[model samples]
Target: MGHLFSKRKSRVTEHDKALLQLKTTRDKIHQYQKRSEATVEKDRQLAKKLIRDGKKERALLLLRKKKFIEEQLKKTDGTLDNIEKMIQDIEFSQIEMQVVDSLKIGNESLKQINAMLSIEDVEHILDETQEAVEKQREIDALLSGGLLTEEDETAAEEELDAIIADAIQKRLPEAPTDVENPEVVLPDVPETLPEAEKKAQKEKVAMAAS
Candidate 1:
């Protein structure tokens, strides 16, 4: 009777152990599934961000290329005008020497104007390209969680406003009232550094001066 009781007890203990093992295995499988789902969601978000970034980059490149082509076309048109003028001058039989000289001066002036225009166009293109790059960086930082701060968002908004203001100023003439009351305000400059840093910087400056 005692043996029978011991055998029964051992059987129950074995069953409980099996049940616990099974539960642990099930729990592990569930945890694995949850982790996988989270990973997949993260990857999806990253992929979406990458697609957006790529589109922005492509758009900026296209804009820059278009602007460059337009500038080239303008320069080519100016060159064509000069060429036609030269051809006309060659065909003229009663062209006075003074008229020929004047045409030469006009051609020179046109060349200078074209050069200045080209420089201005190139500078404008550079500025726009830099702005596009900066915007992309900002977007990248935001998507990557690097700039997940209210201050960052506020700064981005200010920068965007400044960019819009600049564009508006370029496209429209300033009103007299606008000139009198500037919409943009300059940021305050720091007048002094931290005490320790200031002392260190002053020492460095003294050393450099010496």
Candidate 2:
């Protein structure tokens, strides 16, 4: 993996170096083109001056030279344009390569991380957790086992039932018109609503709001 990664990195670096070289060459071409253009313009002006002074032959010679330089300038322009295009292409390819390399590195890292957590390791941990929960339950059962006798538990249940019965009897509204036993009291019942009722009430409120 390390070797492969290093090879890819080296390739990217080489591509960058090649792009730099291309840009340098392009800049040199541009400089040469500027000088060539200046020479061509100067020659054209000199030819015009010679023609005004009645030196047609000399003027023609200078014109010929200017024409040659103009040709070279045209060729240079073409080369410079090509170099510019090449530079842009190289830059785009370099960016693509960098992105590919980054994704590769990320994928390799994820693979390594996944390797560290093998299926066996995960299963082992789950098994240990289950064992721990079972052991805890056994310990709890052992600790609370003798705290309450069967008879004692039964008596406690009976007492609870009697208390519940008495509470229900007290809560019974004898007769709504029993004036002698008039009471102003809240009901002795659980205040918590059932899940279904709560859901229905929420829906009703939402509908009303809408």
Q: Find the candidate with the highest TM-score and give its number.
A: 2
Pairs of residues at least 3 apart in sequence or in different chains that clash in candidate 1:
none
Clashing pairs in 2: none
TM-score of 1: 0.21
lDDT of 2 by residue, 1-210 (tens): 465456432344777788889999988988998898898889989998999999999999999998998898889888988889999998899789779878988898789879989999999999999999999988897688755789987996566545545544566566444367667554545533466754565555457658
* Candidate 1: C-alpha lDDT: 0.59
Question: In each prediction, how many residue pairs overlap at the backbone (N, C-alpha, C within less than 3 A)?
Answer: 0, 0
lDDT of 1 by residue, 125-192 (tens): 99999999999999998789786688977886566545544543465543343466597655543444
- The parts of candidate 2 lying over 4 Å away from their true place are 1-13, 118-210
* Cα RMSD of predicted structure 1: 51.7
Top lDDT model = 2
